[model samples]
Target chain A: MVTETQQRLDETHAAAAPVIEVRELVKVYKGGTRAVDGVSFTVAEGEFFGFLGPNGAGKTTTIRILATLLRPTSGSAKVSGIDVLAHPGEVRREVGFAMQTVAVDPLATGRENLELIGRLRRVPASELQGRIDELLVLMKLTESQKKVVGTYSGGMKRRLDLATALLHRPKVLFLDEPTEGLDPQSRNALWEELESVNRSGTTMFLTTHYMEEADRLCKRIAIVDEGKIVVEGTPAELKRTVGNDVVELQLEADSPNELERQRSGIGRMLEGFEPVAEIKSSPAGVQLYVSDAAAAIPELVRRLDGDGIRIGALTMHQPSLDDVFMRYTGKTIREEQANVHFTGWY
Target chain B: MIGVAYETFLLGRRAFLRWARVPGNWISTLFFPLIQLVLFSQLFKDIIQLPGFKESSYLAYLAPGQIVFAVFLGVSWVGINLLMDYHNGYLDKLRVTPINRISILFGEMVPLFVTCAMMAAVILVTSLALGASLVTGIPGALGILALSGLFGIAWAGTSFVPALITKNEQAAGSLSLLFFPLAFMSTAFVPVERMPGWLQVVNNWNPISYVIEAQRALMSTGFDAGLIGKALLAMAILFIVTQAATIWAFRRLTA
Candidate 1:
């Protein structure tokens, strides 16, 4: 039955139209900056689309535009086939947005807030109560439903926000860094909840700066940077674009810059890989993005040892989305976020 | 529209229920209006000369005026409530819901304006107990109610333009910038007739003044229909203007 359900869903998605579609989306704020500079992507009917980027990478801007909160300066987007600009109300009806912070009213009880949203969405009165009860249980807030939201823990508030967004049973759910600023435990729990939500056939369009989050949740991702989509594909496919594995060499050197220069020279010989994006010194050590770590390691070591930069530490791991991100942007996501804060909007 | 009204009614019930958790807030919603009625009626009695003047009768005439003032103050004071919604993301729940978005404002208005009107009536009845006569009858009484509500529409509308524009609670309360002066410029403490030539000209043109005068005329016997019509018309125009400004602000806010 599980297989049957999965097969039916796959076939249904194959037959059904895209839930979200954006074409040449451009958003220029009141200032002169272009946040989403002619970026575009499509989200299939039931796909969990991760819009991954560093902080300044226009992820939130795109999400806000898609959520119908902000209008694009040019270009267009449609949620569930409804043009966001032309029919924002209709788009709003089809999508549920849980913004970075769960903005639940502290004065009201969790249950009251849910009921209020239910009424706003015009949920049938009889069905509304049952749905609220179901969401309470789903979010594990049944025990605290009657308590004022102000008294809720950060995780609890976030859960309620998610519940409120889901109250109307929207076709597309947009979560903007849903677990951002959350503790590791809370984030993992929320991730599990989101996975279950996906299992229930909700098309989630999630924007996240956390690479692990994108890797864990998104079937495919668009790695956006500097207001443009640098790459788009499944996580595995994008990682293949980098290399099968990433190797980092912690070399004992008097100077970091000298070590960086040494790594670059050793990096040039391993041009056997079709796409050797770049070799950059990662925060941890001198890192190389290569096609095959096993194939390149011995040759890389001989070449580096020939240069007299003794390796203090050597570790090899499968390329993560972070490495894939570094390949495209010449920097890791966290480095980009630290180096710049995004002041523009999509 | 009926759905909107009903939903607001439901929300009002919920918000009012919050008093059970924090019962102290009810004191101001009920008692604050009465205090203004008593304080202003006594303090400004001789200074504010109505069309029909009496030292004792001043309190009676000032009840409806204060009622209108109460609604203005209440709605504007609750600007922080909307800010709290913004901060907590509670408003987003309403934003994403399939229902009419106007219900968000309507729900606020239901308890706020309706309660202001009810409190205004209680003040009016209390003034009667203290020897204030009904210079006008049931129509006039109902007119007072209408005046308080319309003033509320304007106040609620005016407050919304700035409420959501603010980022957090402190900025939201900065709404008092618009509120305090708008209250004072109208007929809350003094009859529009009592203001100096320049200020009188300003007051005559003020939308809030029209609401006060129209409401005052409805509650007093010596009232003229033409002034009442003009006052009501001014309020109607201001109502449309305020609502448009609010919706535009909302549009900007979402943007």
Candidate 2:
């Protein structure tokens, strides 16, 4: 007797049911440092979820808890509906993890590494050889399959690391900064490969501080800071919250007194504009958040000239994931990365 | 149980393969004990002339002790690769797998057992070639190797402690210093009766003294059930305690 709309809603909910859930998870290390504090989130089935954070922002700690590598101080987590704490072995069977650190044996050959992992994961003997060959070919590692890992380049090692995680065909794959140190070309190649992996219907939970990685790959991202999630939404939705575009204006004055006066002078001129949402002035320049930067900049230039303020340069920027991060976290990702004081060992 | 056993075998094979790949490690593990055996035999040949020295040749007397020494040295290096695995994050990779955690411990032990057994055979053969003979022949030599392998297992358990706690290669390597004092204080170089009064008491208290005496008995005399049984009991206690501590430390490190 359900209506058509209600039936559609039920179907949508069933298809996107949570595969990973964290409830008030906290991890306090020895001596009183809290690495993860009261964090909670859910990653739905087949969702490409990204956890974006700077170093020491508790991203690794949260990932470790879910991977069953470390026990949480309190609260609960479930992976694929199995309690991470109570049934860790069952969860391990369903989840594959590639840590920030590459985990292959340097002296072992590429094929040896994959075969060892396959045996450890208990892939059937009949299928293990074919699976190993398939992964080697898929990763383009077949040519170097017999070479020692120590001789392999960084990018090659990373590919083998991914190959190991992909063995046994895990339902959920957890990758922690998989492309942190790769070159642009290698990063792009890995991105394409990961996209194909996601296309095959496996849920992916990736953690990275790279803005473009999250923006391009993840369907939804959670920006975490100081052990807490600052914002969570799709890239477009989060950028929409910031505004349509940003106008960066560089204006110079003859003296410090004139510069101070010119700053307030521009603020006043832009204040009455209907498209302008907010205006912030800094020593470097003035930034205006607006609905349409193209239409507002022409009007802004006319008013500046009428007010006798000199305009040095002007540029318009579309709202990006970086802008969304700055709007919520009050600092750029690079600045936050520099300011981080790492306290606990992972 | 069979799955765990099979996994342990595979893990063991992997460890041996790692050893095979490194030629420098190959030469050191193979020749280091032989070099030590030859040097100690020549240097301490006069020890047999001392009072209370019952054995005919110092090399003969020192051979069993050297076999035990080879086992100790080989087993101590077991944690070196484990610490390497820790530094490079392989341990975390293994933790997330469905493989039995005990295999991680047992797997490393396999290579150590092979190394110890190899060294045991080499030192025994070297001793025999250098005019040291076994009273009970090949069977007695095999018994000495088997018993020393058991002690190697016990010592290997103790070696894992430093590796798990420190997770540093140098710190784990320093733990080998523990065997130095045990080696010098026990009845390894000279018979306990010839040792100083205070040292004789210390040697009596040292577990290595029982292991040496048991191996010496099997090597010089025929089978002595009492001596071997006593050594077995002492090793059994050490194995139980050290292995328990290792398991606890491993759980804590991962936890």
Candidate 3:
């Protein structure tokens, strides 16, 4: 009975709806620790959004709230347009959560672990095996699918855990520090897999302290600190706000006076250069903030050639997410040591 | 309710597989009781000749108690499985699913019936191999296994309540020891008549004694509905009390 115009309007409206929406969400732990404080953000459907912060920065707390694993103390969170608190059951159907800790049965085979979760998620019985086989191949776990997870490597366990989350083809996937414990190679591999998953049209909401991870994966990121987000933007936009790329010239100076002389000499020579925004003296040599360090470096070397400023080394690097984080939070992310407690039961 | 049952069935299969794949789980559970069955039956061979004993051999009387002992051993640390899930974040993973939350608890509980019954059967078969008689035969053996499984479900609360309250596996494990004295005081090893008068009075109210007595009746005598009914009544009361507390504790922990 619907007209063509009305059907088109409905489709447009559905496409415009945000998959994840939050407003002033707060979660205070039992001892009055405000884990998530007044956080709000929205993710459009099929977007790869991330929360970037150090440990205990409420990233996990916020993701858990959105995942409906922990109830927030105040404010609202909606996943796929359903309120998380009012109807968690419905919200759960639209989302998959890959927790920081890998949760898989060690005694069960990889296929068994996936089947158990797939059944619980109500994946159709008829298509379950075919779906599992597809995922197993995608995850590169086809050979190990029949082996118990206890015998699998750490990276294999993580992939299997992720595959379990992906079994039901949720509209959104919430990954909390998905690569926290992976080796560099495994982390890169997981990042590629995550990108492919997002390409298949699942919105990804990831939380991590890894700057490279956020920079590479997220279309937009919110930098969180002390239970609140300090800034939010696309990765490139955030880095742009931190200003120019840095080009450091390690001058070959025999004494402090020579170093200071060469620093001022380089600064005076580059004072009128169009690419140079600011110049400063560093302990080793001169540091220049330039619009594009790679393009400006040859001219800079030419300008300093007649001044007896012998450059020991020249290094030009773009401002990274770490720079953006430092600009906003006034601190770098410090990797904390993991504490192990002996419960004596095992 | 149907949803809960369906979810419980799915999760219970995982729980059962987890137990069956680990040979240590059943082996350690049966080792203590099997050793006790073989050692106690021979050590107390002449004790069956005592005035209060009506059995032909000590092995026949010892078999039922050992069967219950196997069931008890099977469940003593059962709560640790749930605690492991909590620590490892499997519970959180399950919570994120759309299934009923209580299904996680029931998933754990439902599997105990099969495991406890199988563990009891091992001791039962072992006892028979060692020359114990089942006077009522196969039906009686099935009855004894049914009682053992129910007792396992009822008694698991002793481990679960502490585990949930303390959130500590060691505390749950050590707290189960506090119930061992109750088993010893029951007519597990000695008849009520051989105990002191005050002990005999306590045995009348001891739920373990009722279960052991019902199982003993099945093993040594014909089907005694009176004894079976008393055992069922005792276990029903114990099941109601423990399961109610367990459900409350589970709700609190999950909440």
Report lDDT (CA) for all predictions: 0.76, 0.84, 0.89
Judged by lDDT, which candidate is best? 3
Candidate number that wins on DockQ, 1 or 3: 3
Q: Show the colliding residue pairs in model 3.
A: none
Candidate 1 DockQ, CA atoms: 0.51
Predicted candidate 2 versus true structure: per-residue lDDT over B146-178, tens digit per residue: 887788888887678888888777877887676
Q: DockQ of candidate 3?
A: 0.79
**Model 2, position B255: C-alpha lDDT score:** 57
TM-score of chain A of each: 0.87, 0.87, 0.78
User: What would the per-residue lDDT of candidate 3 be over residues B108-165, giving only the tens digit for each residue?
Assistant: 9999999999999999999999998898989999999999999999889988888988
Model 2 TM-score on a 0 to 1 scale = 0.90
**DockQ, ranked from best to worst:** 2, 3, 1
**Model 1 spans > 4 angstroms off:** A1-16, A74-78, A81-90, A250-278, A289-315, A339-346, B1-52, B55-65, B77-93, B102-111, B125-143, B162-203, B206-231, B252-255
In the range A251-328, model 2's lDDT, one tens digit per residue, is 777787887778888888776778888877644567678887787777878777767677788888998887787778
Worst 10 residues of 2 chain B by lDDT: B24-33
Model 1 Cα lDDT, one tens digit per residue, B1-255 = 887787677767765555345645545655766787787778876653456343346776676567676666666656566556655656655665555666666666566656656656766677677666666777778777766766666667666766766655666667655567867877766665667788888876787777776666666554568767877788788878878877776656544
**Better TM-score candidate (2, 3):** 2
In model 3, the runs with Cα more than 4 Å from the true position are A1-15, A247-316, A335-346
Give the CAPRI rating of model 3.
Answer: medium
